[model samples]
Target: MKPATAAKKLGIYLPAAPQDFQDSEVTRAEFNQLQQNPPEWLAELRRNGPHPRPVVAQKLGISISGLARGGVTEPLTTADITTLLAEPPKWLVAERSTHAAVRKQDLIAKKLHSESPKN
Candidate 1:
């Protein structure tokens, strides 16, 4: 797989990865190995991340749009994310509620769909 694909799967920002990792393709076996037992660099990146937008959004329990609305245009480290979670701003609080409501609606829709007759 491409380095970007590998990085996306690993959930780290691609540019933050080492040059070698950015330069090379990752074999399926290597990808699996990395997931099962990450090297120190990968582990450190994951643990103390300048994480990608998707990761930041997931960590914050909000959508990418919510992040944009909150004016978070850049990647954020774990400490940054921790701070946001600990002392959520008004925007973050509002976004979380919106996210929860969307999730609830999604669950209800799925339940209704499942209970309906299938073609």
Candidate 2:
């Protein structure tokens, strides 16, 4: 499979697989290293889950759809997903705060309306 296709499976982007490396080849040193200490980046991705997709995409100033389309499927390392789970954009933070404020205001308005005499 093409590198991009592989990456999409894992929600990552790989411009091209190393030409000199055989796709099926795996060295003991690399395998041992992975077994001993998996990349922290991958661990974070697994922990965060899919909620970060939109956040990271927005922060990176890239369209969510673009990220989705560019996602890889195979060898879906945790690192790839971690990138998507990275910090959210400031716009989202502001939006969430605004939403909370509006909710609070609505609750207060409702309480006041109910307390007041209705003509």
Candidate 3:
């Protein structure tokens, strides 16, 4: 098999497909929350202030103990959520990965079509 055919057989592609920005939009509230509010692990690293967990619990009208036990790590404060809305982070590499996966599927389909004999 030629290099291209061999590579295709191995599910590899050169010059990967362009990333899709629209599909990469951050719609998950929890993920957005975690990115906006510094995680407890990160806050401790920066030493900027205490973990915002207590403050978030108070704002949400939930007991800190309840929030913690509920495993709701990285709960977002109102301001954090607002800021996230104002300016969200770009998941460039993630989008690229998704695009590549979709393109690979398309390539595989094309290869299969070419291989199949038609009546």
Best by lDDT: 1
Over 4 Å off in model 2, which ranges?
1-86
Q: lDDT ranking from best to worst?
A: 1, 2, 3
How accurate locally is residue 44 in candidate 3, as Cα lDDT from 0 to 100?
A: 42
Clashing pairs in 1: none
lDDT (10s digit) by residue, model 2, range 25-83 = 44566545634675554345434433244444544444455454445223333454455
Clashes of each: 0, 11, 0
Over 4 Å off, model 3: 1-90
TM-score computed on alpha carbons, candidate 1: 0.96
Off by over 4 Å in 1: none
lDDT of 2 at 65: 51
Q: What are the models' TM-scores?
A: 0.96, 0.30, 0.25
Report RMSD for candidate 1: 0.9
Instruction: Give the winner by TM-score.
Output: 1
Model 1: per-residue lDDT, tens digit, 38-77?
Answer: 9999999999989999999999999999999999999999
lDDT of 1 at 11: 98
Pairs of colliding residues, candidate 3: none
